[model samples]
Target: MSSTLPVLHVGFHKCGSTTLQAALFGRHPQIDYLGEPREEPRSTEAIRLVRDSCYVEERKRIRFDPERSRALWQEALSDVAPGLVPVFSKESLTQPEFYAAPDDPNLPERLRAVVGPARIVIVTRHQIRLIESLYLFHAKGVHVEPAQQWLDARQEEMHQYRFHTVAQSFVAAFGRDNVAIFPFEDMKTDAKSFARRICDFIGVDSQHGADLIAGERRNQRVSQRYLAYSKIRKAFGLYIPIGRMMPEAMRRSFNEFVAGGREARIELPATFVAKMEDYFRDDNRKLARDWGIPVEKYGYPV
Candidate 1:
């Protein structure tokens, strides 16, 4: 067996990251997938420090001890089998704050200091679909505001979809050869094929990794009616206390019961999607040209 290679799947979420992560967790003998750094106390503190130091307020900075963070990460991955590749997948690492400044080295440098040399995997979807999915995700998870209001509040963050900028930062820090970008649209079309590609990239046997291709999806989107009802419940402050009181499994079951098998359809204004498509046109073209992703295949105009 080849020596284990450390792989970090820093997600650009609203993509198929949950599906990929679920597929890889404990299913392959040659790969050890750690779901999230925050799941462990030591790694949580280390990640928090990395985030704090990397994503400070404008004109402000915070410092953290690198040696401590490194030690924490080393400890976190110590339990994995020696010959198996170590994969750490975390979706929150793609939050806009880390990439807000195009030139910032803090995020990548901190990551390098802790994880050392590792393959970086980033998965992205077209901006229009991604943003709409993100908006619904926020509404379901935390925000009570209407979609338009929530979107308005996140204008700056939406720019993270200019994927080349984010990918370039990692390329600069980790070298171009170590960075891999996959389209979420491609994954949705052929998840098994996509999983095989990732396995090949990480130097694991494709046959062994094939088992990581099928599983229950995590954080599936609820229907429009369900979301609207959630909004009303939040508006009336009826959801807050109930959400706090109920266990997560119970809350999820209750939500599923209320949704009554409604399909996962979200109805955003057509003009809104058109405008977003226009807004991301140049960036999508650049992604196609530079990264070889045929954005047009995913319905983005090239």
Candidate 2:
């Protein structure tokens, strides 16, 4: 096994994954944050993998080949440790459909097979707020069906699929001792402290200090038009061109005009908060047991 495997941030997305990734990649010298030519907003290899896998499936309208999927997994692993403690933060891994069961025996086995004895970090937030933010996130990208419907479908998928279960996959693979799970809310609330905690867990120092913890919610906007465009692309199943095809001028316009200014804070409803509290209670319990976290310390209703 390679001595330095990538630090996999298997996220429960909208949990400040982008903000943390941007801060880390923006400042850290030793880390190589992967993305496309035009400062790729995303940070995980798994997104491309999932999209590509889905693309192939849609084209043939068929199921994925296990051998092919494994090959792609190997290809993703190939990029690991090109630098010391390279970070891979893809929330898709937490998606339920990816694993047969949340506690599936195959997860850790597969991860070990690919990334070797790795340290895993799982970040989570209140479910209701997560879904609301996700709605805004999806909204900011492209226009689509009714927001409530989208949320419902996503919730179903999440419940059926489960993120907490996915964490077990890593624990099974790396052993409970090697995995460090933290609350997304806590990180946002106290970035410096969280960074120190994370550094301690991963055996790295925080070069940038607490100041690196800049914003509570970063890159939090998507305009109606952007959403509409996104919806069209999704419905038609077209690629939106990965990066750098547009001129700088056009990119700026898209950022300024279409994106409705960078990092706009999303507004969420109170009801969503109530729902999330109910949803994550069990998951939090399981996570607390697995990672030895004080659930009350994070102040989640759980």
lDDT of 2 at 151: 59
**lDDT by residue for model 2 (1-302), tens:** 12465576766667777776667644565555453222323223334444334321245323433455446555655554644555666665565555444565554564555455667877777665566566766654534556556756655455622446666667778887778777776776777787767666665666453456655446654666566556666778665632246788887776566556344344454565567567677877776766666667766556
Per-residue accuracy of model 1 over 197-257 as CA lDDT, tens digit each: 7888877887656556754456666776677677777878775645557899998887667
Q: So what's the TM-score on candidate 1?
A: 0.84
Name the best candidate (by lDDT): 1
Error of 2 at 144 (Å): 3.6
Off by over 4 Å in 2: 34-83, 160-163, 207-211, 214-217, 221-279, 289-294, 297-301
Worst window of 10 by summed lDDT in candidate 2: 35-44
Q: How accurate is candidate 2 locally (lDDT)?
A: 0.59
**What are the RMSDs of all candidates, in order?**
3.7, 7.0
Backbone clash tally (model 1): 0
